[model samples]
Target chain A: MSHSRLGRRTLMLAGAASLLTAKSGLTVPARAQGLQPTTSMRGGANNYRPGAPIVDRIGGGGFLMHGTVRRAGDGAPLEGVRIQIWAHTTEGRERDARSHGATLTNADGVFELEMPQIVPAFGQPHGHLAYDSGAFETVFLRPVMDSARDASLAAHFVLQPA
Target chain B: MTLKHLRAVIAWGGLATLIMIPIAVAANSEYLQYRGPIYIAAGFAGIVALAVLLVQPLLAAGLLPRLPIQLGRVVHRWSGLVLLLAIAAHVVGLWITSPPDMIDALTFRAPTLFSVFGVVGMWALLAAALLAAIRKKRWLRPQVWRFSHVFAASAIVAASVSHAMLIEGTMGALSKAALCAAVLCALIWTVWQVKPWRGVRRRQNSRR
Candidate 1:
C-alpha cells in the first residue's frame, strides 16, 4: 500500500478505537459537569435520616470536615438539619455498596464528616455534602480536596426558610 | 476421538470460555460484596447480556464451524430468549435497589450519561426481540422486516456497548472493555458481510 493509503487506514483505525473507548474516560457533558446542589440534596432511602450519627460510616483518610448550619435570615443555628456526604473512594463511585448515610445537625447546629480518599481513576477529588431541614431550603456543598484536608474545615452552611 | 470430533470439542470449549470469562471476573470483583447480592446479580446479568451479544453475530452469520446452520439457528433463537431474561433480571434488580434512579433512567431524566445509553439499548433490544417473535407471521414485507431488524440490532449493539463502557461498576474494566470492543467489532463485521445497506439502497432505487 502507498504511504498515503496506509496513513488513511491508520486514521480510520484511530477514530474507531476512540469511539469504542470514549465511554471509559471523562465524557460528561459541559452543562452537567459541575456539582448539582439542588438535585444532589435529595437523599435516598438508605441515606436519608433526620438525626443519624455519621462518624462510624465514613472511611479512608483521617480527614475530617465539620460545620455548623444556620438560618440565612436570622442567623440562628438550625438543629435537626439532615446532612448527607458521598465521594469517590479508591475503589470507585459511591454505589449502594458504600455506606453514605445522612445525618442531622445537633442542638448547636454542629456536624462533622470524615472524607473518603480520592481514586484518581474516579476523576476529580471532591465531596458532595447536602443539607436538608424540611423547614428550610436545602443546601448542597461541594467541598474540594483543599477543604477536605483541613483539620477543622469549619464549613458553615446557611439555609433560607421554605 | 476422530479429528472432526476433536475440532468440534475444541471450538465448543473456546466458545464456552469466551462466554464465562466476563461472568467470572464480575463475580470476583470486590465491589460486589459491598453492593450486596441484588446488585451483584444485576451486574452479572448485564455482563451475561453483553457476552450473549458476541454469540449472536456468529450465529446469525453461520460462522460457528462446528454447529450445523440448522442447529445454530435453534441455538440463536434460544439465545435471544436468554438475552431477554437477563435484561429483565438486570433492570428489575436495579429498580428494586433504586426506584427513583430507575425511573429517571427510563424517562430520560437521569443525570448520568450512561443511564441514557443503557435505557436506549434496553428499548432497542426489546423492539428487536418483539420483531423477531412476530416475524414468522409475515405481517410486514420481507424488506421492511429485514430493515427494522438490522436497525434495531445495530442500535442495541451500539448503545449497550457504550452503556457498558461508560459505567464504572463491579465488572473488571479490562475484561469489560475487551468484551465490548469484541461485540462491536463482531456486529460491524457481520453487518458488512450481510450488506443489508446495499439491499435497502437497491429497493429505494427500484421505487424511483
Candidate 2:
C-alpha cells in the first residue's frame, strides 16, 4: 500500500482515538446530542430564559398564558408570573414566523393578543409565548382545564424588535 | 451476492444525491422560490441519514442478511457521504441564503439541534474514514480501531436522532411523527444488535 494512504489512515485513527478518549466519561451537551432549543423570552437584557411557546385557550375577555412556572428548588405555582405574548405570521414560502411585536400581562398576569390575524409572505399559522420576561421565546403552554376536562384552545402571539 | 442488490444500493445512493444537490443550490440562492423546498429537502436528508446510521451496526453484525455485507458497507459509506455533502451544501447554500444560520452552526447554537448533530457526525465520520484507510499500519492495532469505530458510529447515530427530534420546522405534519418513530425503532434495533453488555454478562457467568 502507498505510504500516503497509510498515513491518511493513521491520522484518521489517531483523531478517532483521541475523540473516543475525550468523550469516554464526559457527558455531551444536550445541544450536541441533538436537542435544538428555540428562541427564549427576554426579561430585558439581564434575566433570559428559553421560552418554548405553547397554545393556550382564552377565557372570557382577557388573555392568559395558563401554564405554571415554578422555582428551581420547590414546585410551587409561581404566582404573579408575567408572560409576554408575541404574535405574527408568514405567507407560505417567505418571511417565516418572526416576532412582529409583544403584549404584556394585566393584574391577573394574563396577556391577550392584540392582532388575531397576520399576513406575511408565504407564512403558516402559529403563535409564540415568552415567560417570566426571560429570554426563552417559545414555551409549552399547557391548556387550562375546564369542568369537562377539555383543552381550551385559542391563538397566541409574539413580540418583535422594532 | 446478486447483481440486483448492488444496483439497488447504487440507485438509492444516486437518487439521494440527486435530491440533495438542488436543495443545496436552492439553499445558497437569494431567489424567493428556493426557500421552502430546500428546508423540506434538508429535513428529508436528515431522516434518511439517521435511518442509515441506525441500521449500519445491525448490518455489520450480520443481522440483516437480506442485505449483502459488501453492499451494506457501501450503502453505509455512500449514504454517510451524501448526508455530509447535503449538510455542507445546506450550510454553504444557507450562508448564501441565511447568514444568521451559518453563524449559528459555527457558534454551536443554530436554534435547531440539527446543526450540532451534523457537525459532530461530520467530524466523527472524517476520523472513521481516515482510520479505516490505514487499518494495516502495525502501530495502530486492529482491535483499537474496531473499538473506536464502534463508539464514533454510536455517537453519530445518537446525535443525528436527537437533532431530528428537536427540529420543529422540518418534517412537519404526520411525516415528522413517522420519521421520529422510524428513528426510535432503528436505534432500538442497533442497540440490541451491538449488545455491548453481552460480553460483561458472559464474563460474569463464567466467573460464577
Best-fitting candidate, measured by DockQ? 1
Off by over 4 Å in 1: A1-47, A53-82, A86-111, A115-128, A140-161, B1-17, B201-208
Q: Please, what is the TM-score per model?
A: 0.68, 0.45
Worst 10 residues of 1 chain B by lDDT: B199-208
Docking class of predicted structure 1? incorrect
Q: After superposition, how far is residue A41 of candidate 1 from its true place, in Å?
A: 6.4
CA shift of B155, model 2, Å: 0.9
**Number of the top candidate by lDDT?**
1
* Chain A TM-score, each candidate: 0.54, 0.29
Model 2 spans > 4 angstroms off: A1-88, A92-162, B1-35, B110-118, B133-139, B170-208
C-alpha positional error of residue A125 in candidate 1 after TM-score superposition, expressed in Å: 11
Looking at model 1, residue B169 earns an lDDT score of 66
So what's the TM-score on candidate 2? Answer: 0.45
Clashes of each: 1, 42
